[model samples]
Target: MCDILVPLTANAQRIGTEEERKLLDQSIQLCQRLLIEVTLSEATKLVGRAEYEDALPGSIQALRFSLEIYGSGRSELIPCYILLAEANLGLSRFKQAEECLCNANWILIKTRDNDKKVKSILYRGFGRLYAAQGKREEALRQLANDVSPNAALTDTVC
Candidate 1:
């Protein structure tokens, strides 16, 4: 992927015709999306392997690229935020995890996104965060919402 992106990025820095510039811009965007996906996959693998320290930087990079590509309020950011929250939770950084979850919740609210799968992931992240903090009741509530069909339409945020 870097092989493709490196040349495109270098070419992007040079002056070009209007049509060429548009094509270059499109190619860059596509490459960025690929990079984001690959980074997220690697970070997720690291998190799964309980390598939170290793995952943190990649998660942050994915989040940064996602924010740049999709903007702050888009639903696309939810997964990035959730991954970051999960990594932070794994590292026992409760405050940072909560902040990331809250940012994701804010994006969901701002965008009015009602995707059940997305909400489930967000809820699960919160549930894990609360559990890590020893907030059993809060964790259970979030976990319940994660599995409850009716909870998908509700405006629940941590």
Candidate 2:
């Protein structure tokens, strides 16, 4: 089930013909009903294993599916963005990672979401991204933000 749904959902995002859009809509519906959690979990595990290349498609699929379900700039999409950032960071794709983190930050700002755990994840991702880029001071600042009790309220990553 996951094997089939994963590619279907991921590829549907590309070929944007009218027929593909219809297929994408159907795929999104199926993903929401059944495969979202499974796909995300697999993607997370792949990232945990440092298999960034393998994880990208699943992370992307999860992000698109979340977008379909929650709309843009919703807090619900934060985790998917974070996961993508993590994968990109692992792969040394710094620009892509930064973009993903920026997207998450924008969503946080737009939604005014105050979930500390989510903010922690976002800051941690930024910390790692900066660290990977050899920006020591920025890395430390982001890591500090990740741990600071009031960081969620004080920091805006965008």
Instruction: Give lDDT tens digits, candidate 1, residues 1-158.
Output: 55764664464364689998888677777877888898899999999999999998878877877877888788888878888988988889999989999998988888887777778888888888888888999889999989887886566565
Per-residue lDDT tens digits for candidate 2, residues 1-158, read 76666565465335678998788677667757456687689999999998999999878878877888778988878888888999999999999999999999888878887778888888888888898899999999999988887686567555
Each candidate's clash count: 0, 0
Q: Which candidate is the best by TM-score?
A: 1
| Candidate 1 Cα outliers beyond 4 Å, as residue runs | 1-14
RMSD of 1: 2.5
Global local distance difference test of model 2: 0.83
Top-lDDT candidate index:
1
> Candidate 2, which segments miss by more than 4 Å at Cα?
2-30
Model 1, position 111, has a per-residue lDDT of: 88
lDDT of each: 0.83, 0.83
Q: Over all chains combined, what TM-score does candidate 2 have?
A: 0.80
Q: Any idea how many clashes model 2 has?
A: 0
- Which residue pairs in candidate 2 collide? none
In model 1, pairs of residues that clash are none
TM per candidate: 0.86, 0.80
